[model samples]
Target chain A: MSIEARFRIDRDDFTLDVDLTIPERGVTALFGPSGCGKTTLLRAIAGLEASQNGYLKVGDEIWQDEQKNLLPHQRPIGYVFQEPSLFAHLNVQRNLEYGLKRLRGVTPKVSLKHAVELLGIGHLLERKPHQLSGGEQQRVAIARALAVSPAMLLMDEPLAALDMIRKHEILPYLESLHRELDIPVLYVSHSREEVARLGDNLVLLEAGRVQAMGTVSELFSRLDLALAHGPETETVIKAVVAGYDEEFELSYLDFSGGRFAVAGKRLPLGSAARLQILARDISLTLEHQTKTSILNIFPATVDEMTYEGTAQITVKIKIGSVAVLVRITRKSASELGLQLGQAVYAQVKSVALLS
Target chain B: MFTEYDLAALWITLKLAVITTLILLLIGTPLAWWLARSRWRYKFLFEAVVALPLVLPPTVLGFYLLIALGPHGPIGGLMETLGGSPLAFTFTGLVIGSVFYSMPFVVQPLQGAFTAIGERPLEVAATLGASPIDRFFSVAVPLARPGFLTATVLGFAHTLGEFGVVLMIGGNIPGVTQVLSIAIYDHVEALEYTQAHWISGSLLLLSFLLLMSVYALNRRFSVVKP
Candidate 1:
C-alpha cells in the first residue's frame, strides 16, 4: 500500500506542486532546502493546507479528493511540529491524554503506556510542559501524537528547534520509534545527517518540485542530484552486525556490498544497523592496496562520474548491489584515470554506524 | 446613614451593572473570537466598530440609542407593533445602552487574548482530534482566562460608573431607573454635598478594587504564558 498525493498550492512568493506515491511503511523523508515547500507538502497531506485541486489517499481511505476534503481533525494522522507545541493549560499527563481520550472506538495501535515507555517520559508525567527541557517537551509531543494511534505520522523538522545537545538527546527516541513502530511516517527535514540515518525512502524537493524520489542509498549515490553534490553528501547502507572482536575493540558489519570492520560498538549480533559513509571520507585507488592502515576497503566498479564545481569530481561506484560515493580532487582523479565502468578499490576512512 | 433613595439607587446600579456585564460577555465573546480569527481584509472595520465606545462620547452614543429605542424609531416601532411599550426609559433600555457603552472594554481584551493564542495550538488540537468547537472550549477558553477576567471586571466597573447613557435613556425614575451615577448628579444639583459624597465614595472604592484585583490576578496568571 502507498499514500498518494497530488497538490497544487499557490502563495504570494512560492507555489507548491507535487504528485507522488510514498510507501506506506517506514520513514520517507521530504528532504529539501528552506522555502522548498517541505512543510507545505506535509500540511497538505495532513489536510491542514487548503490547497485547491488537491487529492490525497492513505491506502484505501480517501482523505481528500475533488468531491470532498477532510479537515485536519478528521484525518487519522499524527503530526509533530518543529516546536513542541504542548498545551500550556494542560499538565504533561493531560496533554498526552488529550488525543487518546478522543479516540472514537478506533482500535488503538499504540497505547498510552506504550508511548510513555517508548519516549521514556514516565517520570515527567505529573510535571507541566514549562518544567521540562526543550528535548523533553518534544518527546512528550511525540508521545502524545503516538498515543492517538494514528494511521500515519507527519513530522516537520521535529529536531529543528532544538540545539545540538538536545537534538542528540532526542535522536535516540526517534530511532527507537523508527525501529519499533510499524506506522508509516512522512518525515520532513533539510539535514542530510538525520535523513541519512533515519530515512528509508528519500523525496528530493527543490523549488516546489519533486526532483527525485528513491531509496536513500539510490538517491545519495546518484552523481546528478544535489543530494550527492552538497558538502554533506553521504552514502547510507543497511548492514547487519556480523561479529565483534574483543581484543582490539572492533565490530564486523556485513552488508550486501561486503563486510566492514569499524570501531567497536555495543550491538547484538545479526541486528540491522545503518552505516553512514560520507563522500569526503572515502578515497579511491587503481588497485587493491595491501597493508594499508584503512580497515574498510571493498572492490567497486565506477557507475558514473560528474564534476562537482571545478576542483573536485564525484564518483558513484557500485559495490555488489549497493552504491557508494567518493569525492576526489580533479588532479588526483586524472592521475588515477578514474572512468566509468573501471574497476577500483574504495578505502573508507571511517564508518559511522548509526544504531 | 444612607436614606432609602440612596439604598434604592445602590441596588438598581448594581443590578444594571451586573446585567449589562453578563449580556456583554455572552454577546462579546463570539464577536471578539470572530474578529480575532477572520482573514477578511476588512476585519479591522469590525474591530473599529467594537472599539468605538472607547473613544466616542457616551452622550453621543446615548443620543443615537435614545432615538433608536424611542417609540417612533425603527426598534421602538417594532416593539410597539409587538404590543410592548417603548424601551427608551426602561431598565431594559439602560442595559442595552450600557452594553453599547462598555462594548470595547469587554471585547478588546478578549480579542487580544484570542489572537495571542495563535493558530498553532488550534492546529495541534485539530491533529489531536479536537474539533474546532472542542478546541475552543478545551484549549482557547482556558488559555484566554486572563483576558476574560480583564473583560469581565472592566465591563462591570465601566457599567457601574455610567452616567450619560443611562441619564439620556433612563430618565431619573426613582426606585426604578434611578442609578448611583444619576443619584449623585441629582444630590449635587440639589446642593446635597453629604449625600453625593456617600454614593460617589462607594463607587470610587468599588471601581478601584475591581481594577486592582484584575491587574494583580493578571500578573499572577501571566507567569503561566498559555
Candidate 2:
C-alpha cells in the first residue's frame, strides 16, 4: 500500500503543485530548502491544510476526494510540529494521553506504555510541559503522537527548534521510532544529515515542486541532482555487522556488495547499521591495489558519468545492487579511460557510521 | 453602619454585576474567538461595534437601550405581545443595560488572549484528534485563563461603577433599580455626606482590589505560560 496525493495550492506569493505516491512503510524524507512548501505538503497530508483541488488516499482509505474532505481530526494521523506543541495546561502524562483518549473505533495499535518506553519519558509524566527541557518536551510530543496509534505520521522538522546537542539527543529516539513502528512517516526536513541518516525514501522538493523522488542512496548518487554536487553528497549503504576484529579495533560490515571494515565503536554483531560514504573520499583505480593504507576497496562497474564544471567528474558505480558515487579528476578519468560498463576499483574511504 | 436600605442596594449591585459578568462571558467568548480568528475584511466593523461602549457616553448607550426596551419598542413590544410585562425599569432591564455597557471590558481581553494563543496550539490539538469544539474548551479556554480573569474582573467592576446608564433606564426604586452608584447619588442629593462617603469609599476600595488582583494574576500567569 502507498500514499497517493495530488495537490495544487495557490497563495499570494507562491504556488505548491505536487503529485506523489509515497511508500507507506518507511520514512520518506521531504528534503528541501526553506519556502519549498515542505511543511505545507506535510500539513496537507495530515488534512490540516484544506486544499481546494486535492486528492489523497492512504492505502485503501480515501481521506480526501473530489466531493469530500475529512477534517484533520477525522483522519487517523499523528503530526509532530517543529516545536513541541504540547498542551501547556497538561502535565506530561496527560499530554501523552490526550490523543489516546480521543482515539475512535480501531484498537490502539500503539500502547501508551510502549510509547512512553520508546521515548524514554517515564520519569517525566508528572511534570508540566514548561518544567521539562526542550528536548524532553519534544520527546513527550513524539510519544503523544505515537500514543494515538495513527496509521501515518507527519513530522515537520521535529528537531528544528533544538540545539545541536539536543538534536543529537533526540535523533536516536527518532531513528528507533522509524525502525520500531510499522507506520509510514512523512518526515519534512531541510537537513541533509537528518534525511541521510533516517530516510529510506527521499522526496526532494524545490520551490513547491518535487525535484526528485527515489531511494535515499539512489537520489544521493545521481549526478544530475544538485544533492549530489555539494558537501552533503554521500552514498548511503545499509550494512549488517559481520564481526569484530579485536586486535585491530575494526568492525566488519557485510552488505550485498561485499565485506567492508571500519574503526569499531561498540556495535553488536549482526545488527544492521547505515553508512554514509562521501564522493570525495573515493578514488578510482584501474586495478585493485593491496599495499594501500585505505581499508575500503571495492571493484564495481561504472553505470554513468557526468562532468562537474571543468576539473572533476562524478561517476555512478554499481557494486552488486548498491550504488556508490566517486568524484574523480578529469586527468584521472582520461588516464583510466572511465566509460559506461567499464570495470573499475573504488579504493578506500572513511564511512560515517550512522545507525 | 450600613442601613437595610444601603445593604439592599449593595446586594442588588453585586447581583447585577455578577449576572452581567456571567452573561457577558458566555456571549463574549465566541464573539472574541471569532474576532481573534476571522480574516474577513469587515471584521473591524464588528470590533468597532463591540468597542462602542468603551468610547460612547454611558447616557447615550442608556438612551438607545431605553428606546429598545420601552413598551412601544421592538423588544418590549415583543414581550407585551407574548403576554409579559415591558422590561422597562425592571431588574432584568438593569441587567441587560449592564451587559451592554460592560461588553467591551469582557471581549477585548478575551480576543487578545485567544489571539496570543495563535493557531499553532489549536492546529496541534486538531492533529492530536481534538474536534474544533473540543480544542476550544480543552485547549483554548485553559490557555486563555488569565484573559478570562481579567475580563470577568473588569466586567464586574465596570458594571458596579456604572451611573448614567442605570439612571437613564433604571429609574430610582429601592431594592430594585437603585444600585450602589445610584444609592450613593441619592444620599448625596439629600445632603447625607456621611452615608455617601461610606458607600463611595467601599466602592473605591473594592474596584481597586479587583483591578489589582487581575494585574497581579495576569503577570504571574504570563510568566508561567508554556
Candidate 2 lDDT, A1-355, residue by residue in tens: 9999999889999889999999998999999999999999998998888787799999998989988899999999999999998888889999998998898776899999999999999999999999999999999999999999999988999999999999999999999998788999999999989998999999999999999999998888888889888654789998999989988988889999998898847588888788888888899888999998999899899999888778988889998878898888898999989889999898857888888
lDDT of each: 0.93, 0.92
The digit string of per-residue lDDT tens for model 2 on B1-226 reads 6878999999999999999999999999999999999999999999999999999999999998898999999999999999998888999999999999999999999999999999999998999899999999999999999999999999999999999899988986898988999999899899999999999999999999999999999999888886
* Candidate 1 lDDT score at position A85: 99
CA displacement after TM-score superposition, residue A30 of candidate 1 (Å): 0.4
Query: Per-residue lDDT tens digits of candidate 1, residues A36-78?
Result: 9999999999889999989998999898998989999999989
lDDT of 1 at B217: 98
* Error of model 1, residue B214, in angstroms: 0.3
Question: Candidate 1 on B1-226: residue-level lDDT in tens?
Answer: 5779999989999999999999999999999999989999998888888889888889999999999999998888889999998899999999999999999999999999999999999999999999999999999999999999999999999999999999999988999899999999999999999999988899999999999999999998888763
Against the true structure, whose lDDT is highest? 1
Superposition TM-score, candidate 2 onto the true structure: 0.97
